[model samples]
Target: MVTTKRNKEFCQKVRLKSTQVFIVAGTCLITVLVTLLCIGFMTRYEVDNEVANVADVDYWKDKVASSQKIWYDKGIDELNEALRTPRGPIYPKNLRIFLIQGVDGRDLAAYRFSGKDLSNGNTNFVWDKFPHFARLKNTCSQQFPCPISSVAKSLWTGIPLDKIPEAQPDCGNLVNETETPFSVLRQAQLAGLLTGFVTTQRFTGSTGAALGNTNSNYECDERMPLGSLKSGCQDIARQLITGETGKSLNVIIGGGRQMLSSLVPKSISDPVDELLCESNDGRNLLKEWRNQKLKESKVKPIKFELVQRADELESLNASNFDFLFGVMANGDLSGNSNAPSLKLMVEKSLQVLKKKNQGYLLIVEQFIQSGMNKRKELQLLNETLTNLKREEDTLTLVLLTNAIYPKPILDMSEETETINQLSETFNEAEFQIQETLYQMPSESLLFAIGPKSSIFHGVQKETFIAHAVSHVLSKSSPKT
Candidate 1:
């Protein structure tokens, strides 16, 4: 009996020890798992809070939806389909179009000095020049509205009072005749490729003046004889399309309706109508262009059609004729803020230009820098570039502001963070500032994505663009 009791007690003690050991092991395992889970949740919370701080997720979601709406509403997908394929060549048998945005020079130079690869870095240099803040109020005095001459003096000459270069007498004795794109256009016309100038700004704004070479001193002055009046600019527009120059412009679409109307209308005309069409001399600029294009061309009398509505643009036949001038709005086609989108303009222009077997040159200008409209304008431009890339042989050039404003930097930072978050679960390293800072120079960016695009990666001046364009077009020249 004594032996049996001892054995039983020993067995009981062994079982108790084993149970304690098992309990300790199980407790340790549960504690470890719980600790790991807590750590994971804390990490996730930190990440979420940080992301929320950097970006307004809800706002961007809404913005993306809005952008998508705009894209769909304008038939952007259809336009992209059309531009993706190459239209048979126009002249030299090769076609190239230049899309330029006139940002100021200093801003362009700054970005040029900054390295291109820094775009991915945290520096946000490009966005710094023109900070995408709230819109600016019209601050210029009514008596001294901001003129292109004043802006050009600050941008080009760097002196408000300094005289701009005068047009050479050999180039038809035009004033303010600096070496400009107009000279290049004249050369193009001489080469017989059906040159055309299109812009959203008035037909005589800074950009318009550059293309038509109307007057140097009066870049924005629409006055006739001197400005948009009976003088050289109007003459150039008329001659290019209709006059003895014989180089009939295939396209001349823009807003200068006032320049086109006669000073005095028929007796039935309203006083306001007469005033809108009034000029120093009694002449109509729009009528002159219509008449000239409608007139038989010496080489090939091109049929001319003027479209005033978006519906008109959609209904037009693509293979109609050699010359087409589409003017959608009065002064400066409505900007993206108030006008039909750039994608609409680009698709329409392509449709019209595609008629030529001798490849055509189309210039699409978005005046984004004009008062209170930069953000909307640039957004539309970005969309245009993104969509345009769908087409082959289409080289798109985006010209930025001459200087980078500090305001856009904050938004850029926000954008960078958002992209990073979407790309990964968690990124701890702060973005490098030096690399980003390097891209802050105002130098212009020539973002080219087409044949020979590699050549445009480095720092280049504006004049180089014309040369590059000419060279590309020359490649398609008929074998002599």
Candidate 2:
């Protein structure tokens, strides 16, 4: 499920997430600024359109090649050092963020999905067992009804979206790392937690969410780089794996094997790119990961493994390796027939992350499918949640939909027709909305289950998610 009907509408309604912040060698980066450090980001360099083309696959194949141009003037080591701070002493055992993206209030009404005290209209399955539900008022702001990108930024750095310079119309490129001084993930990592961010949704860039969508402030210790199919310029996979930041991610999964599998096509529109999607750049990163393990370090070393299929991922002994890198497709996994199920990915990631005693932060992005399948997914999730051990150390929060309905699809459907009919005809385009309100929608669903979850109540902006994580990290601090 790439996007809900709302997501498809967002494609037309929202353009900010896709707005370019920085385009170096066709590689996109967002410039987030905290102090005056971001003053001259725009003037720093001009990407020669011709030079940006991926012609010299030989030169581009070098791991350092993509980031070399930008890292030179910026001082990569200094930037990474500045970004890396000491973590706290108290590490939460389990903290997971299950973000079901692009799901609107109307989508909830598509069928009868309920939890504990939550339920919409008449329905077949009663999700009465799901627990700790709540909602956020207006998604982000007045201008943009869909504030996935804006909310993501605020949620990451604790800075309101409008306050971001990178968010400006022309300075959109700045929406990336240029202005970001810190992020929830960075803070968590500093606190010594193993972190991984996996998203079924392709690339959102700055336009998606602040640190959540992109590698802004090193959102995840590792990622499942589900790269885009765009040619010429390198996709996100190349930029991140080879980013000049120097902070290493432990595991990356998902699709877009095209980007990392081989050389990016010289022409952005090269037709043969398909055959060569998984092109060999000569630098096999999986082998590189194994090579990385050969060199012993002063600190504890990370073990590595690379697998291509779901069974292979499941078969691995989680304790045997620290860094796991694998790809399942040539592009996004949302609707891919061959890609492993999201359920499998989440379960596998959790299986591996649970091995670490320090605890972890897993960010899972799921595009909700409407109607029965959607409700079933919710049911499956609830069943999964029911099985988890929720102690003081665990915090499983699901940021479900909170928007008001657009004309109410259920209302438009004939009274005699079952919920199934309305769902079958559903298309995200027709449900697009523009106006905004913050009050939690009457039929909304948000769950804050497990240990510390009860602390959240009433209305909230999604940024509160970060605040909660921050509070835990502070306790982890040795000074505390």
Candidate 3:
């Protein structure tokens, strides 16, 4: 009996020791797991904070400003309307309008002059007119003249403004055929809506060439020179505007009249008034297009018209032509502020293009939004124009509001003081002081309005605009 009791006690002790060991081991395992989990959570938090910080930097601030303006001004309303409105898949036969070439979209958001305001004896501000920088009291100081070029470069690349190339120094031979914009245009042409190119720059300039045939060289080809290099503008006007392209172009309009005159010009002293006498090339261009139309009786004949003034454009019969060209100015058409309004241009183009039951593609550009002030104007203009298009079955797309302007940050103290000052000073200020206090950072903005604008918002590359246009056009085409 004594031996049995001793053995049982020994066994009990052994069991106690093992239990303690197990408990200690389990606690250690739990501790390790908790530590690992804490570390992972901390890492994720840090990463998220870093991302937010980067977004707050100058570049993203500009983007946010421009994008928010569109959203606040018209995008949201347009989106709601689109969602509520029933849409038939875009018909291939509908006319296509394009706005390209030049700095556009900066001040487009600010051009919000209401008709009621205009009519109500409030001439405090002109709604559609471009505002000069000198008129802005809040304009940046001399120390920081608005960085227009820097902003333009940044917007084009979607990078920080400082990172953009200062100049495009001759990057060797330009393999123009391979550029993405040209490829997009080629695809557009192949899809079958009548193709047209209009611009204020040389036909060979980056934007202009994107629409026309690609060449290994940038200079107008040997076939089309009038005077010297300085005089090449005339050559561009005559040759490309009226010159033969193997393909039947539905429309061609823009400046560069001096380029069209030949060595044989005699009577007209004013180079602008000189008529493009029928050169072999001009006759051939006309003959070839005529023959093509005759051969394919189903196709519409290409009608050509040169418009120097807005009044001239207004007089044309909308029903008469399938193709129309108007060169409004000698050089780049007047900046949006100084030039005839884009509203006017859009109206005229639509009139001509819509005449065809078969549909048409028209590209209209307002090329003055390169600077900060102009960008703001472009933005406002876009909003106004978009509102105007409410009744039409149109899709308007805006590209590259991406230019980066220097950050305009008002610290919390300044913002508070400004608000207080405004409240005390103005008895009946219609505009909110806070709205003016929170100035936009200069950044590029891109958006699309009309039927399918929602497809574009958020961050995207420039080429995507080209892709979207093609995709939209393709969906709308008759073959599809």
Off by over 4 Å in 3: 1-86, 90-183, 198-205, 216-247, 262-302, 335-341, 355-357, 369-393, 400-443
Best by TM-score: 2
Candidates' RMSD to native: 20.6, 30.3, 16.6
- For model 2, what is the error of residue 412's alpha carbon versus the real structure, in angstroms, after optimal superposition? 25
The true-versus-predicted C-alpha distance at residue 364 of model 1, in Å, is 1.1
Model 1 lDDT, residue 283, Cα: 52
Q: What is the lDDT of residue 291 in candidate 3?
A: 48
lDDT of each: 0.47, 0.50, 0.44
lDDT of 2 by residue, 1-480 (tens): 755877988886556545543244235223344324554443243242222212222322355666575544345433343333223323446678777655655555564545554422333322232335566544342333343445556666766656643322222334455555456766766676666666654422331234433333212212323232221233334445544311344455665445554432232222222422343445445445455556533356666677766678777775566766656554555435555667667766766666534667666766553442666665655555555555556666776653233321323322223234445435434433111122223323566655555556776765666777688666643332
True lDDT of residue 282, candidate 3: 33
Please give the lDDT score at residue 228 for candidate 2.
20
Q: What is the Cα-based lDDT of residue 358 in candidate 1?
A: 52
TM-score quality measure for candidate 2:
0.55
Q: Can you give the TM-score per candidate against the true fold?
A: 0.52, 0.55, 0.48
* Candidate 1: stretches off by over 4 Å: 1-164, 167-182, 219-247, 262-278, 297-301, 335-339, 370-373, 389-391, 403-441
Estimate, for each residue in 1-480, the C-alpha lDDT of model 3 and write its tens digit: 999999999999999999999999999999999999998888688677542232222323355677466445444443343334335444334434334333323333343344445432322222222111111011111114454533322222233434433322233333342442233444555676555555434334444443443322222324443333333332222334333331445655554333332232222222332232223333223334444555555554455554555678777664466556554543344421233445555665665555443445565444443444554545544553654544345555444332233444333233344456775645545465434533433223454444555565555444445556667677655453
